[model samples]
Target: MAKKCLGVREDTGDPCKRPAGSRSDFCFAHRPQEGNEKILNLQHDPYHCPDDGQKLWYVPRLKLHRCGMCDGVLLNEKEIDPLVLESVLGLSKVAEEGLAVECPTCSTDSDLSDGKFALSNFAMEWGFAVQKSKYHSVYYCGVSNVGHCKVCGSTWFAGPGERDALGKNVGKERGFWRVQPGGSKIWGPLDMQQRLREERLRLVARKTEKRERMREKLCQHVDSNGERCNRRKTQKEGSEYCFKHRPK
Candidate 1:
């Protein structure tokens, strides 16, 4: 009997029924290319990072695609719960309104146009035991933004350290806070709502700051007629012109 392929299908989350290739656990179509052990050959086309044009590598073990350049992570809807559980033990959290971005999967599909990834704020609670008293600490997972594709149910973590920040308080006690006997009070639903509101305001402020910075970096190149291009710069560093107007 021929050995079965070890590769998993991304679409249906089922094992590939194809026969394994000689000297490999996966079939030829599912075999990971040489020099890229972490990248898998999934059923769907490869995804690219929206923040950076870098190709997203499919990590079979993790069931997600990660951007090598930006450290961003993309996950399917089914994978979200498992990740949350692994990172923060699925603790009660809050999410704010979504921020829109171009969807990686839908962008490549010819049938889809203007598909968007709506990023949202995911705040998880971390409980700390200090002097035998429990205190709650809220951690936001969207320091850099966690986007979700409304069209495909995919989640994107635009990362330099977003994923790490999500799991920062996992599995460990960090600091101690002195609390009076009656000072340890449990937060009610209203308190959580207040915290969420505050977080939304902070996020809005941060977004505004980012927009201002980007506006400052707008292309400074003038055309032959001396009209300013007024477009965003291609690179964050170096040239001041957009890709089309940049000098060779």
Candidate 2:
């Protein structure tokens, strides 16, 4: 007699009723994919992925829990370095101000606005020229793509592609320096861009206000022939007449 499949249904958490495949404990429908057999025999309770609501599979080889559907990775602070090289991007500090996702391990909500965490894109660059080498690091202020949980130090990368995307350099040209009366400061590209945009709008508002004042001060002098003098007032002393219509 064929042995019963030793697989549990994800939705019902019940053993699979199908017969086991040849030389395998699971049937074709319950067969583990390549490199993911360990997930079938979970020693502990599985955690649900916060991003896709899928079952989080624990991979013993990598010592991390990963979502098979969305390909999102979840790991504690200690397990981060060995598996993810991008831990140097400062996941703890770069999570932007907002609630990203809940922690799969502890179910704690990861909110960056609680004043303990900061947000932005953590970037790095390195190159080699013959026998010489150079490395640089910078931060992009408005990019808050990665989700981080401060409670358990679990960082969530939406997918493997997002992890690779964080490795690229956000060029320095996009940043700008701001000089103030007290001192000077360097601002990230996105932050500086927003500031410059607001300044331009302020200048435009001032010009518009001046034009409206001039329009209101248009000379009200009427000639004896019944034609109104519509010339603009240029006097700073509050004279209501233009040079051409001023009283002699």
Candidate 3:
């Protein structure tokens, strides 16, 4: 076993003046102060002194403006880019609001990323439905009853749907589907399974259209209170639909 020595400065060609031996080559008179202890009086080197003058061996950088001298050891100057220095030293920065936020779910803040991964993290947390709604989901199941995959420019029946269920279960009657990376969830060549998803979309679209029309007409009754209290009631919150913001 190699015995751990006390504090010893590495052997350099400089002759030993104050000989101090610890773990390193310096003799007893020249060891650095104990751990974390401040050396009130530091030896300086005449080479770089009034800094490194006492007797401590430290190199001073005359080219770079930094002195790595410790306990009165000397430092040297080395040319470095100011921009690079500021960046590495946590000195340069942009305004606070300009930064993109990290995913609170993942406890990671990335200034470099444009939040695509963050949104993915959010979707993973809330539910897949949110992602389906936020972006168009393509469902491509080959159930002949609903018709065939219509996505052009590609060979496979791609899956794209507005909802997760529509994409996943579209041609389920024929066989199960597997979601692929190219913005599609694929369906099998079942007879009636594919059409089921299409039907659902159609029904939803129709329902939405009807609701929108109703709200458009109902919004005309809005009052000065920023609410359509009702066709008659003037008190805010007294009506089912506000004139400007009608409920579906």
Candidate 4:
């Protein structure tokens, strides 16, 4: 069921240790596998978060950067824009293009390590929640909240439709929840910028196409003569032509 332990050593029959992993004995600890599960277990696990205590058992739904001391999570999905998180981290205010940043809390690079941490897999463990949502950044929001830390935004709408036990639905989507970097738990999943962007693009394209059609119709009404045009301003102009198209 658990699949052969994968640790059996043919030479000694005692779980062998791989040169790269300190957890080959039983996988109780591991390094960032480079291409696999981010097992948050070792005394110095790299994926250890330092924000809230969500490691070894909890991982942020989405993160862009992390703390190497307490295992805090940051969101940095490609879906998110950069200036967003930068603004939250006090790195920038113009959310036009995302830039490489450094956490005001830590010195980790904000690009590849933007949404991950590696410092809580040592001794302590805590239960918590994560919003897993993002705006311009995988770490914070851009349109809804004022900042990124969750110490002041932890509430709930109960279900997907914002319903509580009383059977009353608010019909609004509340944010997600998670602990702040150094404070109490909070509510988030603040924004879905990628989805927002896609929606915006679709709307613009549709409007542009409609505008092009209107221009074509107006131009066709002129025919070859630029004078008064072929079409008349009569109520039946839809069927009439401009002055050039009139019964020449």
Number of the top TM-score candidate: 1
Q: What tens-digit string does per-residue lDDT give for candidate 3 at 1-248?
A: 33232232333213334534536443454444333111211221122212222333321111111112222111111222333222222311223333323222122223354444321100000011212475665433221111111111101111222223223443222212111111122321222223444555565576678867766545355467876433432235645444445543
Q: At residue 94, what lDDT does model 1 achieve?
A: 34
* Candidate 4, 136-207: lDDT as tens digits: 312211122122322222111111123322223322222232224222222212233334334445555666
Q: For model 4, what is the alpha-carbon lDDT of residue 126?
A: 17
**Model 4 misplaced regions, further than 4 Å:** 1-191, 221-247
Full-model lDDT for every candidate: 0.52, 0.49, 0.28, 0.30
Candidate 2: stretches off by over 4 Å = 1-44, 82-96, 108-144, 160-248
**Cα deviation of 232 in candidate 2 (Å)?**
50
Residue-level lDDT tens digits of model 2 in 1-248: 99887665543234468998998877897776323444553423566776678876655545666666655566567866532334324333433436455566665233343434321323221111121235644322222234555556665554423311224333322211101100113222334435643554555566678877867889868899998788877665878788887777
Worst 10 residues of 4 by lDDT: 118-127
Model 1 residue pairs with clashes: none
Clashes of 3: 47
Model 2 pairs whose backbones collide: none
> What TM-score fits each model?
0.37, 0.35, 0.19, 0.21
For candidate 3, give the lDDT of residue 52.
Answer: 25
Query: Between 1 and 2, whose lDDT is larger?
Result: 1
What's the lDDT for residue 226 in model 4? Answer: 58
Candidate order by TM-score, decreasing, is 1, 2, 4, 3
Could you tell me the lDDT of residue 237 within candidate 4?
51
Candidate 1 structure quality by residue, lDDT tens digits, 1-248: 89987665543234578999989878887775323443344434556777887766665555566666666567666766543423322222334443355777677564455433433334332122224335654443223344555567766655534232334432222201011100123111334434544664665577678878977799978889988788888875787889888888
